[model samples]
Structure formats: structure tokens, C-alpha cells
Target: MIPELDGATWHKSTYSGNSGGCVERGILPTGRQAVRDTKDRERGALLFGPSAWQAFVNAVRDGEFGG
Candidate 1:
């Protein structure tokens, strides 16, 4: 079950900057992950479970998304 995850402390991606292409991430105490656009923190965030997040990271590392 997903836990209540408001108020999580978010961190910007290392690749993010003031150039307007930024992604912010936050890991909840429940191990879920949250992502949002750095330029609009007030907007809704996208949440992912730990397993899904890991899979996404692995895919990125494998260049599955065609970086």
C-alpha cells in the first residue's frame, strides 16, 4: 500500500540548472519516489514505487530510452 507522502524533501537532478531544463526528485520515507519539474514545484508530482523506479534507472543506464 502506498503511504501518505506529502512534505517529502525534494532534490534536483545533478544535471539540472537555471537553464530551464530541470527535474526534481524526492524519495519518500516509504521508499517511494516522487518527481516534478523544477520550474514548477507547486504543480503535482509523479510518484513511483521503488521497483518501478529501479527498473527505470536500469533502463536509462542501459540506454533503453535512446539517450
Candidate 2:
């Protein structure tokens, strides 16, 4: 189960400036990663472990998400 999330400093992707489809991210105290919709920060967020987060970042760098 995801742990309690509070006081996390959420940051949005650099490419998400002024774009309607923007995603925000944050780092958890446990070194895990957190992601949420920039349009709705008060809602729920998706959590990812360090390894998973790294992999996703790499994938994005490789244009795996159809950048």
C-alpha cells in the first residue's frame, strides 16, 4: 500500500509549461517517487519506487512515450 504523502514538493516536467497536458512529480521521504496531475494536485497521486522511476525516465528520454 502507498504510504501517507504530505509535505512533498511537487515539480512539473520542464516540457509541461503552459500545456494543458502536464504532469507533476515529487519525491517521497522513502526515496520513492510520486506523480500527480498538475491540474488537480489535491487529488490522489501515483507512487513509484526509485528503480521504476528511473526506468520510466529513461523510457521518456528514449521517446518511448511518443514524445
Candidate 3:
């Protein structure tokens, strides 16, 4: 089940590229992570459990999605 995101505070990384084409992440009330596009806040977000979010971050750090 999705957690309540009403009061979630989303933030983008300072290391994000200058293109402004990145996603912001927020921690939900249930401890899951929520992600949404920087340019489309009204579109909603994707929710991920703590472990899944960690794995995704690790993959990105490892360049799994390419530089």
C-alpha cells in the first residue's frame, strides 16, 4: 500500500546535472521512498521500499544507467 505523501518534503541532489531533468526523492510516512520528476510535480510519484530505493541508488552510482 502507498503511504501518505501529503507532508512529504522532496528534494533533488546538489550533484544533479544542469539540465534540470532529474527526479526528486522524498521519504514517505511509512518509511518508503517516493520519486517524482522535477518538471512534473502534479503527475504523482513512484513509491519504493527502503531496500529497493537503496538498490536503485547503488545501481545509479555504479553507472548502471550510463553516464
Candidate 4:
């Protein structure tokens, strides 16, 4: 289980609107990224190392996962 999440600042995408259908992102103390469902904050999160997170973001930007 990851630690230090209590102090992590969480935020959703600006494009998320108010549909309550997006995940929130947090930057962990170790510079890793954590993602959790916006509608279920207490359910823990998916943690990713910096490189993996960047790769995922790049893939999203490139439409690798398809919209």
C-alpha cells in the first residue's frame, strides 16, 4: 500500500466538467502519481512512477488508447 497520500493534493481535469465521471490526480511525496475515482475517493488509488505516468500521458495525448 502506498503512503503519504494524506498530504497529497488532489485535482481533476479542467475538462471534467461537473459530470462526476472522471478520476482525480495526486502527486505523491516521492513524485509518483496516484489516480482515484472521483466518485469514490476512499477506495484507494492507482500509483504510477514518473516515467510510466509520463508515458501514459503521452499516449493519451497521441490518442493511443482511442477516445
What would the TM-score be for candidate 3 when compared with the true structure?
0.80
Name the regions of candidate 2 deviating beyond 4 angstroms.
Answer: 1-3
Ranking by lDDT: 4, 3, 2, 1
Best-performing candidate as measured by TM-score:
4
Candidate 3: tens digits of C-alpha lDDT, residues 1-67: 3348786878896666888878889877778889888888788888889899999999989999997
What TM-score would each prediction reach against the true structure? Answer: 0.75, 0.80, 0.80, 0.82
Candidate 1 at residue 36, lDDT? Answer: 84
**Which structure is stronger by lDDT: 1 or 2?**
2
Evaluate model 4: give its lDDT.
Answer: 0.84
Off by over 4 Å in 3: 1-3
Task: Return the number of clashes found in candidate 2.
Answer: 0
Q: Model 1 — TM-score against the truth? A: 0.75
lDDT of 1: 0.80
| Residue range 1-67, candidate 2, lDDT tens digits | 3445685777888878765988988877778888888888778788889889999889989999895
Q: Give the least accurate 10-residue stretch of model 1, judged by summed lDDT.
A: 1-10
Residue 56 error, candidate 4, Å:
0.8
Q: 2-44, model 4: which lDDT tens digit per residue?
A: 5678778888966677766788899888888988888877889
lDDT of 4 at 17: 74
As for candidate 4, its clashing pairs are: none
C-alpha RMSD values across all candidates: 3.2, 2.2, 2.4, 1.6
